[model samples]
Target chain A: MSFALQLFDLVGIFVFALSGGVLAVRQRLDLFGVLVLACATAVTGGIVRDVLIGAIPPASLADWRYLATAMFAGVVTFFRHGSIERMRNPVLMFDAAGLALYAVLGTGKALAFGLSPFAATLLGIITGIGGGIARDLLVARTPVVLQQTELYAVAALAGGGIVAIAHALGWPQAPAMAVGALLCFGLRFGAIRRGWRLPVARGTDSDS
Target chain B: MSFALQLFDLVGIFVFALSGGVLAVRQRLDLFGVLVLACATAVTGGIVRDVLIGAIPPASLADWRYLATAMFAGVVTFFRHGSIERMRNPVLMFDAAGLALYAVLGTGKALAFGLSPFAATLLGIITGIGGGIARDLLVARTPVVLQQTELYAVAALAGGGIVAIAHALGWPQAPAMAVGALLCFGLRFGAIRRGWRLPVARGTDSDS
Candidate 1:
């Protein structure tokens, strides 16, 4: 991965870990539990992606930096959890950013694995949302991905599509990545700011 | 794949789903979130095991029964959540049983895939704990597997090892599976009852 891409991934992991830590604190988990949650959120998606694509030893296990980053973030959050609690919108904002970054990075990695563009895009969305889904399941909540909230998957698709198109047109990898990331970030932030959401089915009269 | 084994798998899934549903209620999750968590906890480990062993489509999506079982449990919990809350210890005991069942099943499936016994045993542990790990991460808590609790992994290892040994001895598959499952449950139950625990290392003075 390019240095900038790597940087983005690191930052994304940190942000996601922070979100996990904050949520753990909110749930009154002990320190160990909080740290585990942070690490799981930060690394689980990449681990799943690598495993699916047959990357032996999986980057999450091989890369010490990712673990260290998550560990540091978890510790910081554990010690100063109250500040995170005070930020009412922190989880939403951080999770959105992490999703955008991860979606782009995952798509880019899929392309690197020589997958079809559509498959790459789909994998991107999966990678972006998979960890959170895993985390939510552990915490016994519905994952945001399945909720009728803003079009999170749509935003991931848009980002992945942008990267795929750029790559098809022979754009440099860096530019392609940037375009993907910007698209994801912009769409997610816009959705959050404007409260954009997909329509939900109305219950029938007979529905309880 | 034996009828008896399949029956146990279905029972394990059902009990596990019930535990997951109880957790959802305890967490005060909404209906959708509760169902998602229940299904995920009930099936994600098997899904991961199948995917890792290159079992096409994975069991979660291939067999409708697993999804139906989990969803039904979720709905039941929604309607009779009060009953679940009143039976906390039973719910936990069932969850522990499911963990052992999944672990053995996963190890057996991996072995059937022609993986080495060692790998199969490892896969069994993963399958056993993976769903709960995923569940915890989603809810932003530490995974129960990594906690300082009873000898969870030790139970999986014992069960998986017994299966491998039975295979080596050319024992009948049905008996072998039963042995494996029984070993796991027995050891786990023993640990719970006797308060068996692994030793933890304190931080070094240099670090302090």
Candidate 2:
């Protein structure tokens, strides 16, 4: 990744960690618990992506910057949670930004690892959602991604698919990534503001 | 791993998948949902272990047999759920057995990848509980391992610690693994049957 992209990755990790830390504070978990959730939420998605691509000791584990950034976010959130709680649904924008970056970046990495384009795209989607799922599960909240609310998965797929398609066509990385990220963020932002949602299964009482 | 260990791995996957399948049926999830949960439960731990150790395309993804076994378990559970439900807390035994196998195997694999014994032990514990956690979270159950009512994490730690210690002492792998698995299963069984519990943080009304 370019220096610009690497910087964006840290930013994404920071915001995602903030969400985890805020949740821990709301749950009244101790300092250690806050830090644990923060770090786990920030790193899990990338860790899963790296692991699948055979990258040992994932950047989250091997590179101190990733964890350091998470801890910093955690400590800050711990002290400033009152301000955060006062904000209106603060984590949503952070999540959309992180999702967009992760989707594109994860797709790029998987392609670099020689995965098939389809597999890489799927991995990208997983990368986008994995951390959020972990954070929600840890805090005992039902996963919002699985809840058929907003166009979360659709936005990620759009971002990841753009990267994969660009790669197959030998397009320049920076431009492709920029457009992909913008599209993902736009889609997610629109979905949130305009109420785009997938139609869930009907007939609540029906089952196999 | 040796042939016997590999066979046990399959058995572990089967039993764990059975738990997921049973849960899905009880929850009245559709057939696709049932298979998804079953496969997710069966393969998540090994996938995490392999990813941490730089194993590409983790066996759960690379090999067909692991998924085949899980699917088989899911299909059987779907059909025989009446019989399974008739049994007494059957999934508890299956979970303990799977936990024991995963802990030892995960530890051994981590060591083989040259991680420090402490790190390997921790990884082993994560591997033991990872699948169960995923299964519960997907179905909106509080993670059983995180609940203070059970000795799940402790049993996994003991089993993983034994494997790490045995390796550090240059003990034979086969015997060490057998003993480790037995110890883990025994501890978990006793904990569940005897209602052993961990101390929970008091004063639920308190906040930071």
Candidate 3:
């Protein structure tokens, strides 16, 4: 395994766990419930992605690293939730970066499995946003992805497409990953700053 | 499908949708959000179960009835939120029944597809519990299945095991399905009524 890739995965899981932990505290969930939500948000995406890619006994179950990282993050958040909540914006930015990293990684993995680009991109988005979706669904609400303001999905798409482009051009792995991450962060931050969004059709099916 | 089975399927879908809709309204979500949640809970499991079982395009995507039933239930719930909330117990009972019916149907489908008994039972549980899990996860809560609960998993197991046993005995479809459904409801309702619970290990492994 690439050390850099593994580092990115660890960071992604940690950040997502932090996000889930913050939300759990916000919702006033008990300790076990907090851990449960944190784990769900931190690991569900990669597990689903791996399963869909036909990686049996998903990475979440096979490798101890992801679970350990998520659990550690959850525990850390449990003790430092107040401080973490006060730094919400910065934490969200970190989460966005993690989302980008995961999106690129997921798409790359899907492509490696010989899926079509369309399917790969879809998997990338799913891998990127699925954790948050699962997190939201557990709490009984519409996912952040479907909301008008959240640029979460856009960031994933941009990062995934960039990875695909670099792959087409035969870029080295390091350069491709770096560019993909940059594109993802750039698009995500830009969307947040500029209020960019996909238009929801209001009155007509044709608009969609 | 047997007419009785088809009828129960429709009822189950509607009840599931109602539960979703009520929860959405309680959360102060918009109409579209309510509809999405309702539809997702009502059909996403069967859709996923079908796709995983290699039923191309999936039943949810193919059948308009499922969508219509869910959407209508959502609409009705939106307009009658107060009344529906007042009848929460009855609604829950319906939801439980839906769980039984869905589990049996899903198990039967898995068995027909030649999956092993273990796998079929798992698929049945997934099919039965999956929608609620998805719904809860979207709302950012830990799913009930993963939490300390009385016999939800066991209920799905019973239903699936019944189907497997009946298949092993060369029983016809209808009787097998009935047996499975009854087993599920019996286990689930019994647990609920008796407050039966499985013991959780104490914090011997804080690391776990």
Candidate 4:
């Protein structure tokens, strides 16, 4: 990976780890639980993607930097949660940045792994949302991605789809990735600002 | 994998799928949710172990049999849930069978992957409990494995540890696996029968 890509990924991991740690505190998880959630949320997406694409020992496990970054985020959140919680907008901004970057990065990685465009796109979405899903699961909550309360998965899919299309068209990787990330960020940021939600499934009982 | 191992794994997957489907039904999830949970619970453990051990495309993904078995179990539960729910003993029996089989099977697979005995043992325990954890998470409940209500992880660890030790000692695979399975089954069954529980962590707030 290029230095730019590595830096982007590290930033994403740190932000995601912070989000996970914050959630852990809200859930009243112990210190161990906080760290576990933080690390799981920060790296599980990439791990799942890498595993599916036949990359063994996942980057998260092979490289100590990722683990250290996650742990650092966890410890920081543990002590400074009160102050952090008050800066909700900045936190949400960081989360959006991470989400956007992960969507494109995951798609790019899957392509590099020689997956079909469709499969690569799917993997990219998984890489974007997988961490949050794992974190919510650990805390015993329905995953936010599955909920009809936001455009999270839609944004991810959009980013991943863009990357896949670009790859298929033999477009330059750097520009393609940048455009995809921007699109994802724009959609997610708009949804957060406007409180947008996807239409939920109607009640089966009422239909019956 | 030998025919015997294949058969054992199929049985475990079927049983675990049934448990997942049943849980989804109880949670009032739709048919899609039921199938999703069934597949997730049946395959996640093996997938995790394979990924960690550098076995890509996971056995669960590479082999169609695993998917077929899980889907069949889910469909059966969807149709026969009323009758199935009435037979509590059978459900518990199946779960125990799965738990026992997965523990040893996972350990053996890890050893085959050339992982260290300790890592293999950990993977085995993960394989035993990972499915149920995914099932509970999907339904928005705390994982039963992590709770203090039973000797679940302990039983798995015992079985896995036994297999690791036997392998390290150059014991024949068949006898070693049989012994591990029996030990796991016995411990899990005994815990269920006697209502045995691990001690809960005392509340910290009171101490503070």
lDDT for each candidate structure: 0.76, 0.83, 0.78, 0.85
Where in model 2 is the C-alpha error above 4 Å? A1-39, A45-54, A62-133, A140-208, B1-3, B169-171, B205-208
Runs off by more than 4 Å, candidate 1: A88-91, A202-208, B1-128, B131-208
Question: Which stretches of candidate 4 lie above 4 Å from their native place?
Answer: A1-47, A54-125, A131-140, A146-208, B75-80, B194-208
TM-score of chain A of each: 0.90, 0.93, 0.90, 0.95
| TM-score (C-alpha) between model 4 and the true structure | 0.62
For candidate 3 chain A, the 10 contiguous residues with the lowest summed lDDT are A24-33
lDDT of 2 at A143: 74
Q: What DockQ, between 0 and 1, does each candidate earn?
A: 0.09, 0.14, 0.11, 0.16
Give the per-residue lDDT of model 2 (tens digit) for B50-108: 77877767989998999999999999889998987777466788779889999998898
Candidates ranked by lDDT, best first? 4, 2, 3, 1
Off by over 4 Å in 3: A1-47, A50-208, B168-172, B204-208
lDDT of 1 by residue, B1-208 (tens): 7687678788778777776777787788999888988888888888877766678788888899888988999899988999888887777678778877888888888878876666577678778877776666657765676555557766787888888777767777667767888888887787777777654322212221
Classify candidate 1 by CAPRI docking class: incorrect
Better of 2 and 3 by TM-score: 2
Estimated TM-score for each candidate: 0.57, 0.62, 0.57, 0.62
Local error of candidate 1 at B46, Å? 10
Question: After TM-score superposition, what is the CA distance of residue B77 in candidate 4 from its true location, in Å?
Answer: 3.9
Q: List the residue pairs that clash in candidate 4.
A: none
TM-score of 3: 0.57
